[model samples]
Target: MQVSDYTIGIDFGSDSVRALIVDVTTGEEIATGVSYYPRWKKQQYCDAAANRFRQHPLDYTESMTDAVRQAVAEAPDGVADRVIALAVDTTGSTPVAVDESGTPLALLDRFSENPNAMFVLWKDHTAIGEAAEINAACRAAVTDYTKYEGGIYSSEWFWAKALHVMRDDDAVAKAAYSWVEHCDWIPFLLSGGAQVKNMKRSRCAAGHKALWHPEWGGLPPEEFLTGLDPVLAGMRDRLFDETYTSDEVAGNLTGEWADRLGLPAGIPISVGAFDAHMGAVGGEIEPFHLSKVMGTSTCDMLVVPAGHEGAGAQVKGICGQVDGSVIPGMMGMEAGQSAFGDVYAWFARLVAWPLENVLAKNTSLDEATRTKLIEETRSAIIPQLSEAAEALPISDDILALDWFNGRRTPDADQSLKGAIMGLNLGSDAPRVFRALVESTCYGARRIVERFIEEGIPVEGLIGLGGVAKKSPFIMQTMADVMDRPIRIARSEQTCALGAAMFAAVSAGKYSDVSAAMEKMGGGFDAEYQPDAKRAAVYEGLYQRYLRLGEAIEKETHEDRDDAAAPKPDKRSVAEPSESELL
Candidate 1:
């Protein structure tokens, strides 16, 4: 394939969609476009939130139109008709309630206020109770179905959210039809003509999230389904069908879709796959190398040449393990941190700095102006905080866990709450900030430990995503926590690049994902090797984090009042100068 005959890779994320144009021969990105999701974050249980995190399906359409148009338009002058194949990867477990016609329920006025009308975004944790029931029931099933999920099924996946909607809103139960992922539906929208016999199932999505397995013929028994929610048990056919992997062409873009997007009809389009998995393909990292897409939350994906064994693992507390889920001949192990950069965002809000602006939060500092005074205080205070954090006699009382947004790995429970210990007048933001940072690293460590315990050797981490790209301190800390070197993938948009790789394969320009990845996917951008000294220091601190974490999980499980106070104060000052954080 010549460079002129390119492929387009569209990546649909939680908050936005990005499309990229790339040279098939050299794996070079030619031009790209990004468009944000129209609906912003939805606060839980608000007036408009009927237990739903809703978004208009139109937002996806608008972004898709703008991104694809610009991506093709911007590619070197003559690259329009040269496009061959298109592939898409999106945020996982993000399901939408669409009618038989493939439109989101939120578009209908009567369903506007109903939360079920909106997409049950991956971050929504309101289904924890329902997830617990599913896990409990899945635990009793016979087929060894839960192994694909690492052993436990998270509420964030398909089943729990569906059950929650059924129980929370009668309108959703009666009015809506198929529970479709945005990944599959977007392609369906573009294909226009006689839709595939069923867009209802995607092997990549269903196998990973919905418990639709191959050997069992489909989803687990109706008895297992009824145990979670009778409604779900009965809608088996509606909820699932034969699943297909990402490599399969779900369908072609019909004439209407082709003209709308300015592409040719019948141009091959691959089945939609999860972003994190595709991202691994993008980063050129393969099995055993954990690809951590650290965004609002962290998605950890590991591919194993062989599948796992854990029949009873789907119970709520057990993390799941799926087989033939990612690569055709390989088993894909997936898990996530319910929150990561979101934790930092929470802290940024506390400091009153707009998140994402690492620079220019402050221009200069002056004592009388207060901004200067605070900046200096913070400057002097951070090192002091670091030293104090290291040297100060931290009280046995000082403690905290990283569950502010809930857990998503190893054990998939979300009813858990966050807690803190050891706070006094002296307790301040720097200390608290450092603690929060450590809590996240320790959380990563816990998951790594779980894999190790299961005899799964994680060779190294191919870290790519917002957190890995931006933070050095956190990376170093993670190295210390994981006791392994961290290799940060070079591509800023590895997910987008991964999609491009898929595009190459779909175009027949490349043979398979592995070969395509090696030729096209750029590898590690930076590597953080384990520092024995730092790792040793982190050892002592990590033990403390564990003690605190255990206390929080235990108390939260008991639903007891959390008397443990978290540190909240920061030096009195205008926001610290941006450069100081660096």
Candidate 2:
């Protein structure tokens, strides 16, 4: 009967953080701000001789401070005081090593140079060797340990990264009181470290990244942890105590964080979670609806209804199958391509298509000129090449696996390599670029098909993220490729909107997540049906995608046999230094 007048959601991505203010009653976003992380970067290659990927912890906190201040400052009048709750969505597997008092160790001068002190990004491949060891252990154990996760471990997870840290740097490992994730730590810091028990952990993060499940007693059994590393088993109790959904109240804001963000202390802070899944919550697709957050990468979320004729057993190859990350009282399925918009961005860089220059040159053009020029160029590109990719009109041999980044689902393997099957002088930018787009769509199709085949039903696809907002060509191309109508989010920043919804739930403005989503989530919100002709055509193309994927994977595995990393890169690294987090 009551609605909170306002809420705030902060979305923390790999390189930036966005803060948004929304009115819960109307679901209108009042103001938002994005702050880029100054020291954040994927990887910088100084030369061909070495490879290093890292991001500074300071960069994340600084950006967080800036994003929050700007959003609160820009909010409508009376909006600040009635703001009842807050939430953050962050990339998973970005682990931080913290000391006994929960302070980040990276700030200390000694560990400043240590890559381990920095957040090990979701895509970091440094732990592949450790992942292999863990995977082998899981395969050997063959217990119920990997039940929800389909019996495999990944390099892009908590255990492998933690083991990598301990095995390489004993001092840092010994000093670490907790091997924490951004999803948990960010909320923890906001609630104040002194009141530990009231702090909540996201079930989404627990199920997907930390290997926590009710069947395995919510984290791999102690014996399993010990088998991976003696140090890992030591923190078992601290890791899995409490699990909260994206909307559940984790704790109230502490005075310190409240002062920093210029909000009243005790404004509710919901437990945080992964960006993609939260994006689904933002888009507000009820159970049986799927949401694809297209960004530098693509992550898919589907809500599995309460009863789906044994659907839980039917689902496969997802990052996680958990309850209530979206629509309350139901299972939320999470999966991803690990690269989508990044492919387009990569092509953008390659073509040196200066958006600025292109626009500048056409400044005097009419509105129709601007819209038509962009859309016409895009339209000509999408259908012509993405579908034509498999036929390989010019060079039949050119093949690629979307793993230029790493794998996220279906036996989550980061050790895997991307492959290009055939190359020749005939290949042009459109050809190569189209292949990139096609491969990613193929990856998404594989996930959707797996969900259906495994018995989980996906009625339709709801689109969100920057890609969904910026490019209709890609969304429609995906629709034709997957043969499902693509639904667009009403909110420009769907994840932020989703976060605000959770903020509503945490503030007790709604009964649960579903109630919050239905009431507050926005969108054009209509489904884009697939074209009959396009769907028929894509069926054959999808078959080729599957075959090409198999062949490329086979060849890459064969090569790895001879040129694998000598030792896991994690073993070669040292401890991250200690630092005081503001």
Candidate 3:
């Protein structure tokens, strides 16, 4: 009798790490476990005001080991021995400075307490100045380094963050020999780790963030780096020129990691990629269908055949379009909002402020009772608000701009701020919450419109991640706003499933990613279709959102020459008014 084969998919998310043990034959998820980073859970080494978020290497190493061990232990006896392959997906552009031996500087005793030596998270925007400098330098160069990177170098990407951290700390700069993305470093750690020059790198992160384009023959020439900053001089050569896609095997797990994970020592480990890209694979994304990994932020993914509509199409203001980034033989396009669930999280905190600070201060109740009340109320705030907001009729007077973390698409700009307009005394918490949700939906619409305008087709939307799975109202709102059907992936852990699919291929279970996906792909959990009446009403509200955003941006950049014409009235003539709709 033949033994069954198994593979493990590990996903390193913003706040936690998850591991899924999957059967290769049927793609059934046998067991899963999640481990939150203790340090990150306590909000250590992060400065929200400075836009700096750093994760220590130990957090990743410990979490990966714990999550995998727990997940495997939950499976049937001998299943761990049957595990054939492993793959990982992580938040991208999250790069950490490492020494010559591929060890993150944060793990070194000398730099253990230094935040600059840790992994700079994708959401970190402290490198705005460095990003701007790169953009300006690229614009002036004979060959623009940003031509493939949406013509704009964002502060959220790899090079900018690395440069900023290096320039900020002389000690870190002197000790750091190279930088490694979170996705790449995790796999290397499992593969018995090698020198920085020999460790494998991911094409997804390199092409999207490091500007490693085929046209440039790899990373931009050393001249471009030297021109941008002498600090970056000769650094490109230290980084590997070759990058691997998700399907390839990075290496077999070494004895150390194998013992720690309680798995076989020689199990194959597939190359790593960003969560959104792998989530696209897990969602069974087809050509032209948009895949959205909606979490703290939203990473919108679109993959098309290289010869299809995306061939040579310069999608203006997208994150980046890279070959083999998602699938082996396709062009993967990325775009996202800098804030999505983060917007809701911020509002939830705002609503809970009185319960903790003011209401709890009135200690008529015992301390424990007050604390319990505050905790319960804090947990229920968003759900109650969503429930209330869902019942309320649409109102044009409630409007907002979803730029709390600045814009990430249709031209990357980090200097913007979020705004809530038309908030008079009548604006209740639910009303304001509804407007914020609408603003996020509107933001999604803008990205879709931009893609369509650029001749890149978005047939329909596929939703992944916590927001897509847990929040029905958010998905429904997105459907109504886009006037399109939204399909939610059936698997709760789609990114991990996607990683497992890649593991299947790397373990030689399937010929390629497509075949593995066909066998193990998670189908739609639910489909949210647009309500004609609600969509029609949202059409007008979307227009108001546009005008409101334009006005805010114009006011913010008053000195710009191409300021938008005078804003239009909030009321729309073509659409029904709030009273009429009600």
Candidate 4:
């Protein structure tokens, strides 16, 4: 009997960490486990009102250990012993300030409760001012550092977040020696790396978020960084000068982590990357095919073969075009909506407020019965809303903007807010919900259109993640709006599976990512074809969406300018009655 080699893929999402054990030869997911971050679950170190989202380092370390051990326990006997390697994928640009020893500042007792010391989450928009400054500085620089990053810098990225934290908290800045992305920090920790300088940075995170490009060397020059802010002086030297792709090995798992995870001590660990990049590979992304990871936010990934037509063009208003970011030898282009499923979730929460806030406080019912009723009602909200909305005919009477969390692509602007238009007494929850869903789909269409406008072709779309698997209404709506069929990947955990593919390559089980994907991929299980009538109606509604978006964007900027403009000072001008009469 032949024994198969197994690999573990760990995915650190915004709310939880999941571990997946896969059979290397067949891509069969042997077992899986998930552990939500206790601190994050309790809403610790996060301020939703201020858009300040953070995660403690302990949340990552503890949850990952629990998730991996759970997966190992669930797997067949001897599978843990047969595990050959491990790889990690995480939410990107989620960075933390670190000390000289390569430990997060939050892990130290002195800074234990400091939110500024914790990992700045990708969704945090507190750095909007900092991001604007970086954009202005980049434009003035001798070299356009943001050229590869679609000529726009976002608040949800490395430098902007780091600079925001640094300027906001003096203690964190004074003690911090360097900053590291969550993706890079995990592999270093598992490998027992001690020195900050020794950590192997990820190309995906660096190239896409840190403004790293081959043309200008590793990172933007120190002069450029310091010019943006004196606080960033000498930061380039403290941080990494080189980056490695996900297929490369970071290091062997140290005995400490091995024992914690119930795996072999010396198994190779692949270099880390952002979750969506690996997820695209797991979804079996092909050249020119857009892989849409539809979760809280949507990450749209497209790859073009090297030397292909328009491959080298600097597409404007995208996340970035990084070589080997997705596939080893392909050029990967990324664009995304800051709010996707999040938009639906926000509406659900809004409509369920009475059930949660008022009903929970009622003294009329027993505790258990009330709890059950509330939970059931809350859970059924989306499904029932979808059903009701599906029954209604498509109309332009109601429309919404999906910028509840601000836009992430087609030019990132976190200042933009969501809008609902054409609401009246007749406009109900289901109608509003349908418009919100359509807005998110229209946001996706804008990304697709941007790529096509820039000479990059989008042949089709491959959908993956939580929304793709569960929501038929949203998926069908997306198909109608896009006028394209979307093939949904079979694997529920594509991000984790993608990490396993990189692990296979790092462990020498496969020659490259493509080989691993071809051998181990779980192909699409369902496809959503467009409805011609609905599509035609949506085309007009989509045009309306564009016009609405343009008007809103202009008004948003005008409002911002009005707020920022200096007000007339009554004290500065003499009172006309007394002075002129005298």
- TM-score: the better of candidates 2 and 4: 4
| Alpha-carbon lDDT, every model | 0.72, 0.73, 0.91, 0.95
For lDDT, the strongest prediction is 4
Q: Which prediction has the highest TM-score against the true structure?
A: 4
What's model 4's overall lDDT?
Answer: 0.95
Ranking of models by TM-score: 4, 3, 2, 1
Against the hidden reference, what TM-scores do the models get? 0.84, 0.85, 0.94, 0.98
Q: lDDT of candidate 2?
A: 0.73
What local lDDT score does residue 46 receive in model 3, on the 0 to 100 scale?
97
* Model 4 stretches astray by more than 4 angstroms: 572-582
Give the alpha carbon lDDT tens digit for every residue of 373-470 in model 1: 55555445334444545444333345567787778876876766566667788877666767777778888888877776766767878898877887
| Candidate 3 structure quality by residue, lDDT tens digits, 355-460 | 9789789858898988899888999999999999999898898789999998998789886789998889878999999999999999999999999999988898
1 against 4, candidate with superior lDDT = 4
Worst 10 residues of 3 by lDDT: 559-568
lDDT string for model 2 (289-368, tens) is 77888888777888767776644673556676776666666777777876677666655554555433575377688867
When sorted by lDDT, best at the front, the candidate numbers are: 4, 3, 2, 1
